[model samples]
Target chain A: MNNSSSVIEPKTRPIRKSKIDYSQGPAPVSVNPAWCKACNICVALCPQGVLEPDAEGKPVVAHADNCIQCGACWAHCPDFAITSNYK
Target chain B: MSIAAKEAGARQDSDVVLRYLRPHVKFPNMWCPGCGNGVVATSLIRAIDKLGIPRDNVVLVSGIGCSSRMPVYLDFQALHTTHGRALAFATGVKFSRPDLKVIVITGDGDCLSIGGNHLIHACRRNIDITTILINNYIYGMTGGQTSPTTPAGAHATTTPFGNTEKQFEACDLARGAGASFIARTTVYHTTQMDRLIMEAIQHRGFSLVEVISNCHTYYGRLNRVGQATQLLRMFQEKASTQPKDPNMVDEDSKDMIQTGIIHRDTEKTELCDEYQKLTDSLAKGKSS
Candidate 1:
């Protein structure tokens, strides 16, 4: 309220969010959900960050594009849920 | 005479110069066409070249297998020993002539199935030698029999219903057996294979490099995979790098892992170093 309040404050702007494109993600390899036990062994062994956990802790191929197709996941899996299709 | 004229004359006469170029042993190579044994042999040669060890100071040993014929093709001092005894012979050679660089070339069945005891003891003792295990999944020389490394549920001559026994991971076994330097590479990855073999030879302690090779005639036919290229394609498709956390692996996608160096540790004391230390102390005591 004083007469010395002539200084103006700097304006603060809100940060903008960038749009994400799901189409750019990895292609999904065929998964036999029926055979899956949700053990998540493939999730931990994937060198590429292509897999993620779902709400029930089941493995979900979140980034299939990152898969290099080394058969460690297939060889290590006790149950055969994941199968790769050679393009 | 001008310098260029002298150099040209020397180059022209170089072919006539006496050079000790001879086969280590005669070779009517037993390996089949498109087999990965050639690649493994090339890697071993490149390793020997890089080390620059005198030909007389190196002894190449091999057991009976398709890949075992490597020593026959090399120019170094060599021994084509009995089946499943290459490691045992190599151990004797290393201990007897500690000055020599000893190398053992063997296949999956030859090394893991029969020579496994020798291999474990060699690793346990940490002998100053390099061992290359060419894992081709089937016993190629013996008509496609099941090997210790044949994948579970995979067909073999002995296991027509598919192999029920679990396959042994060679690198893991070597690591567990106390091999100082352990690496795994496939024949398809020649660049990495050459580099890894060279590094293994240069390493002071016991080193083991598991070379996953293809046995087209036997293993391929038994497995219903027609050709070497198909098997190589499978390797390219199935192998992947190790994950950051083994626990974060997907349950569904368990077949994709790449081929590369899996483990390497340079800090451990070599077996020969320990032996020297013990001998030195004993000599000091005796002198006193």
Candidate 2:
């Protein structure tokens, strides 16, 4: 009672490195000043301290490398001022 | 930063959700900075995107209030009706075209006070409409007056000495009125909000998703709840995923805002479908 036809052998594919660099992390958080209401919410809620308020209180990406890309800043931004290409 | 990073930063001007908004409408909405209404609107757009519901198939009906103004900005068939009448208008839309998804955006004042009757009746009928009641606790647009959902002992312009009456539990009210689906989420819980809104929209019977939003400009200043961030943090700290015990006293549940679906009854009949069946039966009898 051999059922060889019913089961297929698993194939092992070669592992390859992707062209995109994994070290850079996700895209830098971009704040649109035109729409920014200077809420400072993104700056306040960012866990990584990636965003900081400018002279006018608008958020700017101060530590782009520290960004874990958790999306807390953009998700919490009430004015829709924060955006990331990776999001 | 690499070339990709540079390009990402350069492309920040174009927002992913901007396509969901009306092009003619101006940027920088009228809501105050850090207002929770924006968070709710964004979460709603995300939910709609995840569901892949076409913009044309959606009809947003809103009554007069800050939250009600959401329909105006979104690029969909919208009707900004009079105060507290958003649910009634949405019911008519759903009845006429069952294919079109009707969503009502109403605020605490407009929904519970002005349109409370319509809300209960809609729930009783079990209409296939989604109502997103934004409970900001105060009338934000009209200068921070006390609303039905305003917590007792909370300060508002009308309740300067603190509200003497008990706060209305919106989810409990909806459940009692026979809504098939009743859920509550706050702006602080963005992920939960998006999921609950999507679930409510997909539900067949009357569904109500009460979004506990913050009115920073008025409610925050009046109540000294700090800025929007502080208020959102408060939500994060106080919101419990566990539903409040039915027997829990007001004092015990006062500080806790329940987050997640509280009640769901899918077996009940939908108003529009039932009405259609009745009409079809009558027409068949007449023809026979």
Instruction: Show where candidate 1 strays beyond 4 Å.
Output: A1-87, B1-28, B243-258
Candidate 1 residue-wise lDDT, B1-288, digit = tens: 553464454332212101222434333244553467755665565456656677788888999988887666667788999989999999888887888989889999999999889889998888888998999898988789999999888898899989999998888888899988888877766667778888888888899988888886777777787555466666766666564345656743454434666667788887767888999999999999
Per-residue lDDT tens digits of candidate 2, residues A1-87? Answer: 111222211223332333344355654667788998887777767666667666777777776666656678777777777787553
User: Candidate 1's residue-wise lDDT over A1-87, tens digit each?
Assistant: 111111111223332331322355434344555545544545544556456656665567786555555543443332334544421
Location of the lowest summed lDDT over 10 successive residues in candidate 2 chain A: A1-10
Model 2, B187-272: lDDT tens per residue?
Answer: 99988998999999999999999999888777888888777777887788789988667787777475788889999998999988
Counted clashes in each candidate structure: 30, 0
Indicate which candidate wins on TM-score.
2
Q: What DockQ does predicted model 2 obtain? A: 0.22
lDDT values for all models? 0.69, 0.83
Clashing pairs in 2: none
